[model samples]
Every structure is written in C-alpha cells, then in structure tokens.
Target: MSQPSPQPDRAAGHNPRSSGPGRLIIALYAVFVVGSLSRAGFQIATRFQEAPLAYTLSALAGVIYVVAAISLALPGPRAWWVSLAAISTELVGVLAVGLWSTLDPAAFPDATVWSGFGRGYLYIPLVLPVVGLWWLWSTRPGTVQD
Candidate 1:
C-alpha cells in the first residue's frame, strides 16, 4: 500500500503560526492599522474643514491600511490577494498624492498621510506599502508562503 502525503497544518481562525518574519510583519501591520485609523479620525473630526480633500484622502488611506492589515493577518489564499490589492493601491495612492502635493502645494493647504511621501510620519506611510508587498510576495505559495 502507498503511504498518504502529509497535509500542511494551518493555524486556527485568522491567526497564522507566528514564525520568522511573519510575526514581525503582522506586528507592523497592526501598528499601521491603528495609527492610520487614529490619525484619520482625528483629522476628520477636528479640522476637516481646513482641508476636506486631504482629510478625505486620509480616511481612505486608513481604510485601506486596516483592510490590508486584517487580510495579511488572516491565513488563506483569499487573504493574500486581498492584502496584495490593498497594498498595491496604497503604494499608488501615496505616490500620486505625494507628487501632486509637491507640484501643487496650494491644492493641499493641509497635509495628508501621503503628503510628501508621508514626511510628517517619518516616511512610514511611504515605506509601509513596499514592505507589505514584499511580505506578501515572500509569503506566496512555493516560496516562504506564510
């Protein structure tokens, strides 16, 4: 009789087994999720009138970050695609907004998370998406694959 191939063990629920860089990526994502959401909420509530466009973009960025974080944390193929899409969109958004802000300061009297490549936030907003994409790519099946 032929022996059966062993099945890969998956973590319970959305949680993945914390090992190597997975744990670090999850931690960073969680922090960004909270940070983006908090900044967006504060901006929208306090001085949204000052820069409606910037504030709205901040909120949108927050939503994207939250979705990416959740999807990355989850264990499954669906989560991978979700995270990839969110991260890619985020990268594009930051780049476009950053360039626009640089070219036309008048358009954005106030700053956004993506302004100047997230200069106020120490460029984490700019770098986060790159890291996210790399992490997702690394975790793809056949490679590290999370």
Candidate 2:
C-alpha cells in the first residue's frame, strides 16, 4: 500500500486561494446552496401556488449560492468574476428583500432565503457577501486562482 505525494502549487509564492477564510466561505456557500435548494424544491413541488414569489426567490438564491461556491472552488479569472458577480447579486437581493419584507410584510406571505436578511438562516445571508468579497480581494491576483 502507498499514498500519493503532495504536488507543488502552480503559483510560486501564492497560497491556495481556498485556504483559510476562503475555505470557511466556500463551506458556508455550499450549505446555503443545499438548504435553499431543498426548501425551494419542496415548496415548488408541494405548494408553489401558496407563495410563488417566495419559493421562486428561494430557488434563485440557491442558484446564486451554487455559482458562488463553484467559482470559489475553481482557479481562474473567469471564476473570480463569476464569484464576484454572484456574491454581489446576492448582497443586493438580501438587502432589497430584507427592506421589502420589513416595509411590506404582507408582500412576502412566505419566507425566502433573503427574507429579513435571511433571518431563518441566522442572518448568514446578510454577511456572506461581505465575507466573500473580502476573501476574493485578499487572495492573490491572477487568472489561475482558488
């Protein structure tokens, strides 16, 4: 029996982009992707008519989470841009939905991932974008990444 030896990183002086906080951020995004997808899938399957807006928004959020997670996991400039775009959109969605939910509670009728800034998810949705952005900026600059 034998184990594979460690391979050298492509970057000469750069650390792995998915190291440290990036790992945490990626893990969180993965959890949200699963959670939002499950919730939206169930709602859409059994009770979409009850709250189409909320359910659809949940599904959209899940897609965004999946994109962000994948972008962060990959190593390239395209992935970087995709990650930024996804996270930025997520921030906007959370803020808009949170404000709307506050101003017009009846409008929601049911909770989405971004409702009340993700209150049901312990407000991680509200903070994730900022953390993700920071991780992106802190990582080394290049086409190959993560």
Q: List candidate 2 stretches off by more than 4 Å.
A: 1-15, 140-146
TM-scores, all models, native as reference: 0.84, 0.86
Model 1: lDDT to the true structure: 0.80
lDDT of 2 by residue, 1-146 (tens): 89987665644433455777788899999999999999899999999998899999999999999999988888756677888899899999999998998889888899999999889889999999988988887764553333
On TM-score, the leading prediction is: 2
Tens-digit lDDT track for model 1 on 28-145? 7677768777877888899888998998988888888788877877777778888889889999999999999999999998988899999988988888788878777777744553
TM-score of 2: 0.86
